[model samples]
Target: MRVPVLNPNYLLTSVLFVLFGSFDCSELDMDGEISLRLEHSLDMGKSWQDRGSLSFSKARSAIPTVNQGPLSDENLSTLENLCSKNMFYLIKVTGDGIGELQSYTPACTMLDSSLAEQITLFLDWRGNPVAANLASRIGVVGHKVTAGKFDTRVQIQSMENGPTPDTAAYIQKMEEEKSRKMSGEKPDNRSFFAKYWMYIVPLCFILLINSAGAPENGGR
Candidate 1:
């Protein structure tokens, strides 16, 4: 009786598939001592008026949905003043004993008496807010909130996708370029010597100098 021998290539591929599939992207500690607050500053961050509060817990899912409190009269008045001056509306997020402020002169908010109600908090994979204070963690960011008229609702959401490069298009482009080159495409029509004349000239000059300095008959 002969025992079936597993192909090494097949075994390696199976192992890799299992390892990659088992890899969980949500590795951050959701139970960390962190809190979020939606605040605004009319005086360019000189002060902050808290408009809403956000809290996270371990009992809930890894990512929690935050429903912001309605905007007050002061908030509306501040927005109006900033819109009149054509200045930016400043927003500050405080978490883990640190504060992060962002400023944007949104045209939507300026043109109409509108405010971006929905706020999404992009957190690092390690369950920390993707902030400058904590720069070591990896996360996906660049979220912008556009305003809706007579609305001031805010929500904080966790980062769904980690820092995964979407390089399929780039890889496809490279493969096409490679295939084109393999198909005898002469994108650079210049000869090798023509393309590398500077290097070749320097090398040839060095060889000539060496030959001139060398004694005749192999320095005998």
Candidate 2:
């Protein structure tokens, strides 16, 4: 009996599939507080205003509150002084009211005419807000930029810290597609001669031509 020959590439692919399947692939359940506040200096760091805070966590998400009023004289004075120095005004972000506060220095001058009216907040995988412009030790950590005013926007976004891919769903979809393709396939019902007619017909034609052209069988 003739044995079926196995393909080397197919064997390698099967081995890789088995190896990956054997590994335990599970998602980690990580959570934390994502409280953030912006402290702005209106008197060139002499004094500051602690803006209303925003929260972004699995438990609850928040939006920034409107400033009670426009920038006070003190705030405007601070911004003008910093602008004269060609320095950007500093924004202090307190994360969960713990650890070192992160700083956000907008390139815009603190003056209302120059200040960018919008800012975005980004969250890490642990649900903590990080500096949007600073380089993260853990790499990019934002999913999307939350759009809000420079002072009141507390939009939350995840970077690389977003959720892991849903492998289970992806695998299920692949399996369904594979099964569908298998079930949709039609069986080969042609006779052997019909399946190999091209090769058989060519060889038969060559054999007939050779036979007709050859000298008649030699006398016995």
Candidate 3:
């Protein structure tokens, strides 16, 4: 068998380059500080630049906003600081007391060549909207993913903060919906077929099959 020709020094250099370039930083920020870090990248994620970090604790306490109301200018400004006036951002919720760190890096699409464009991070709570205005202002999308001891749930919503004069009206709307749902008001505007389309569609198919299987007879 013929032996393959190879350059030893070149291979060693290539290995060293890969080892150096593939390295990453996994260190978190400081302890006990729940915060959102805004970052962006050019050249298709070959490199990145951190804009800044906005503390959740600071923002929540700084604003007098309750569970329901429009997004305050103060709070908006707090989030705006994270972007450093940039239109696009990569949001990362850092700090302590947060359970299992998980991340989602979506594939770059034709609509969005850069993953950092319109990146949204949602911290879901019982009565509050999941940071809607912050997302809209900084160009981010939404989702809630939780890992339980024995279960997991994921909920995704639009980045829209709703109509003007009420940038966070959806919070109030959600509360109202929860009230309606708790009061036994089901959103059953769908027709019987629509409501049970899964069963109805398969059942219709079965009926059609049976009818087709039956011999066709015309009265003589």
The best candidate in terms of lDDT: 1
lDDT of 1 by residue, 116-151 (tens): 333444443345554311011112222222332223
Task: Report the error of model 3 at residue 171, Å.
Answer: 34
Model 1 quality (TM-score): 0.41
Q: All candidates' lDDT scores? A: 0.46, 0.44, 0.32
1-220: candidate 2 lDDT, tens digit per residue:
9999985434533544553343323113234445555565544455657855555544334443434234555555555666677766555556543443444353233343233333455543334444443211222232221222233334445434222233445446446655776999664566746644544454455435423421211100
Cα shift from native, residue 173, model 2 (Å): 21
Judge candidate 1 at residue 169 and give its lDDT. Answer: 45
Name the lDDT value of residue 72 in candidate 3.
36
Evaluated at residue 167, the lDDT of candidate 3 is 14
Residue 146, candidate 1: how far off, in angstroms? 19
**Quick one: RMSD of model 3?**
28.6
Each model's Cα RMSD: 21.0, 23.7, 28.6
Query: Regarding TM-score, does 2 or 3 come out ahead?
Result: 2
Structural similarity to truth (TM-score) of each candidate: 0.41, 0.42, 0.22
lDDT of 2: 0.44
List pairs with backbone clashes in candidate 3.
118-139, 118-140, 119-140
Q: Give, for candidate 1, the lowest lDDT window spanning 10 residues.
A: 132-141
